[model samples]
Target: MDEDNIQDDIRIYTERRWLRFSSGSYFPVYVLLAASYLLILIYFTIGLFKVFPCGPDTRQWEYFYGKCYYFSLETASWMQAKARCEEKLSQLVVINNTAEQNFIQTRTRNDRYWMGLTDRDREGTWRWVDGSDYNTGFMHWKPGEPNNDGHGEDCAHVWGNGEWNDVYCTYFCYYICEKPLPIRIKGHHNRALSVP
Candidate 1:
């Protein structure tokens, strides 16, 4: 081949070799960047799942409508029942609706249990243990009820018939405790993420 042609061929070969080397050198960097991005996405997804966990599993408590309930096997007076619930990071069960009352009735199953309602602070003015007024919500009082009978019945209890009755605060009876259920984000295959 002529001298000029030979030089041109050598130059083209050198250029191709340099291009290949440069591209090869950058391939690992691109892969590393892609890998880092994927890892970050995975981490954020895991964190999101953690923040919005699935349903709570109380083990001993029953779950219903975003709340967990515990029925005391033993009996206690109103004050003692309140203390017991507080110790467990819960409070006396507050009935908010017919569904809740039904649930409690089913759970208690003809057993008398102390409720969270009371008018001890003022006659005829009922309030929940959580300090919320109870004059406006669903009340399941029994017939001729809340007569403040004997002028001393201040605390409330659930009867076996799913009705409520006001009794003396010192009366001993079974009680129910309630707490907010942990956030549970539902997932496939019946999996749920539970928040701590």
Candidate 2:
């Protein structure tokens, strides 16, 4: 009985030693394969997120659809600023999303700026001078901001923190504008439409 037990123990020890030696040879290969897979995954993920080629940096401007969108500027009164923007081959700039509002607010060194929004035509119905509805995507107002100081305050101002607060229409501040890119439709049949 003792001899048989000794032989069993020896056999188990030999098997374990062989397994360790063989597995050691393959361990490095397994590690290398896993590392290579990880590297490939990282490369593809970064490439997928890379931005497409655009034009030169316009600072606080976005060049899209053959138009230059400008932000972070100063002007006096919503009415006067709208007139000024119109004169610049543009209109009062609209903040379409939070990304745009954040971009404008970050670029601005001033305390405030005028946006193309107001309740001038109606008391509570805010509208952009471009005749667009006030879609509340990027709008961040201080608590109770549009309490419209009686009837005199119809215009809107963008604060340093990018919040819209209703101020007197005649108040002065910087403003943003959007200039449509002059379209020179080449190829007689293809007309390039200036859109967002």
Candidate 3:
């Protein structure tokens, strides 16, 4: 064959080979790529639905029972302790039940720690710092304690033995602060969470 005819034949053969190779081979590759993207999307969607658990974000605080507790390393008066807790957006630990009292006792290391209860306002009607009625909840007073000895004791503190005692609010003692965990709702729309 002549040179022109040979060149034309080569071109036609190359086109035919290219078409045959691409016609069926690309479908599987496309499907695989599409599937990979779909899997990635599914992974993120499921992750979004997962309710990231809430807990304390600061190393100085401890997370427990949907609340954050901070045991102050320094001693302060009852009023000072309350101010410090307020600075951290928390309040003195409030014991609501036996289990909670036990939990605080374990952390006390047999040392006194100021609690949230106090009868400062009315002497007999104790109240929490949050303004909750103390008479309505659990109490752990020491035997024959809270006698208001000499009628001076007013603020409440947890004894080394985990029993409650009313002492002078000005007495310096380490205190425990408590902050409730932010409420978390489980649903598609409420997926975003703020933990502290």
Instruction: Give per-residue CA lDDT, model 1, range 1-196, as digits (tens).
Output: 6999999999999999889778797678888999999999988877654443322234567778877788999999999999998887788999999999999998888888998898899888899987765877888889989888785999999985889999999999999998876544456523443332
Write the residue-wise lDDT of candidate 2 on 41-154 in tens digits.
977744532321121223445655445766544557778888887775578877777676677677655477887888877788888877766765457777898998775789
lDDT of 3 by residue, 1-196 (tens): 6999999999999998888768966678889999999999988755643332223235577767877788999999999999999887788998998988888999897899998988887877788887766667788898998889976799999986899999999999999999876455666344334343
Where model 1 places Cα greater than 4 Å from the true spot, the runs are 1-57, 183-196
Query: Model 1 residue 18 lDDT?
Result: 88
Minimal lDDT window, size 10, model 2: 49-58
Pairs in clash, predicted candidate 2: 73-174, 73-175, 74-174, 74-175, 75-173, 75-174
Better candidate by lDDT, 1 or 3 = 1
For model 2, the local distance difference test gives: 0.70
Instruction: State how far residue 186 of model 1 sits from its true place (Å).
Output: 15
Report how far off residue 47 is in candidate 3 (Å): 13
TM-score of each: 0.64, 0.57, 0.66
RMSD of 2: 14.4
How far off is residue 163 in model 3, in Å?
Answer: 0.4
lDDT of 2 at 139: 71
